[model samples]
Target: MLWRGRRQSDNVEDERSDTGGSGGFGGGSPGQFRIPIGGRTGGGSSIFIVILVVLAGWYFGFDPSQILGGGDSGGQITDDSGSEGGGAGAPASDEMKQFVSTVLAETEDTWKGIFQANGLTYEDPKLVLFSSQIRSACGFASAAAGPFYCPGDHKVYLDMTFFQQLDQQFGASGEFARAYVIAHEVGHHVQNLTGILPKFNNMRQGMSEADANHMSMQVELQADCFAGVWAHYTAQKGILEQGDIESALNAAKQIGDDTLQKKMQGYVVPESFNHGTSQQRQTWLARGYKSGKLSDCDTFNNPI
Candidate 1:
């Protein structure tokens, strides 16, 4: 990805200098994450995580709004998130800052076009850059939870160190892979604007755990698809280099619930999967990349 010299978004809130103090995130142990399950408790892990692992079930797609303000840890499903450096991420260098800002700007441009074409307005969501931990309207979160979009505050939060983790820990590298991560969270902002997220959030309260997980899968997969749509238009700008799409696809595959579960434990519990499987994620992303059409990303309507 030839991202240098690109326009950087002014909407970014660089709070790295503030360094929000440490506190227990979601009341879970630091450097690890817990998946909240309703009316279910086992040996303190997901059936998919008994061997001990989880991505917050949302590395790139974790929406803190769902977990925020939900009381009690009796159903906490804990796992090692490879986040053991303990919330103290070094500040994002100027170069990294520029890259992220550029990616955000690109996403802003792409979504604006799509929304305008459909006779709607597009709102550019703010992206917050933080170190270690930060307080959000969705609640307090650590970088270990990975980058997430908070509909409560209409902001995307990040710890730039996650890009290094994505490459070294998850075996997903390349600039476009990082871009896809940013785009996916921004996609959540799009869903929030178009009422998809609001609908899911309202309905999930009444849904069974399994049914809610299924719905969450649709929401997350659509975000992945939206990321691909961003990539589709990005390619037209003549900045994409060879192997860019493959890197993004690999990033999607790496964070899929099934793939991460297998990589951590050895098997998968399809019922506990909130994000789509590796194949499903890749398929949706590829579909959107191929068509560049929001119509192709109806995970709720199509068999995914």
Candidate 2:
């Protein structure tokens, strides 16, 4: 993608070198509790219970990331009634920072135009470049949690190292693939603004485990489609290079529930699929790319 020399957003804040604050990992409101991914637990849990929670999460598709948060430590799932999280770390090079800002600026432009056409205003989400860990409105998060968008504060938190992993660990590379990651998270921001995220999240509370997994799949697929919509507009601007679309599609395939599961566990569990299969992800992404219209991204109502 021809992102350099393009408009760069001023909304990015880099906090990589600021890790020593808030007692290193356990600050925030008194009542705020975190669900650490696999960190130490204050209320120690046996590995058996940890395995159970992981199995439960896999079986019911209950959660993807609300597991290990921080300071108030545990390997179990925690309620979402907490404040932000994160710590200080190293920085990505200046060029990477520019790349991130440029991509974010493009998303701002694309979404703003779409929202205006739909008679709604667009709010630009703040993008934070942190190293290793960071605090977000949704609670504490580490780089292991990957890139995420927090609806509570309308900000996207990124650990740039994930880009390296996307290439080396997941075997997906190319700048546009990196851009797709950012856009996918930003898509969640769009869902939040559109009330789709809140509605679905609330609806999941009373839903059966399988039903909630289905709902979550819709939510995630729509975000992938939204990323494609962003790509659609981005391509029209003459910035997309040959094979750029394939790069993004490859990234989608690499990170699909089935692909990741097979890679990690050496087998597939169909019922635990909350993010759709590789073909489904690529299909939805391509569907949105075929038409830039937001109306084309009805993953919830249509068969995703």
Please provide, for model 2 over 164-202, each residue's C-alpha lDDT reduced to its tens digit, 9 standing for 90 to 100: 888998889999999998898899888778776666555
Off by over 4 Å in 1: 22-93
Which is the leading candidate under TM-score? 1
**Residue 94, candidate 1: how far off, in angstroms?**
1.0
Pairs clashing within candidate 1:
87-132
C-alpha local distance difference test of each model: 0.69, 0.67
State, as a TM-score between 0 and 1, how close model 2 is to the true structure.
0.77
Candidate 2: RMSD to truth: 13.7
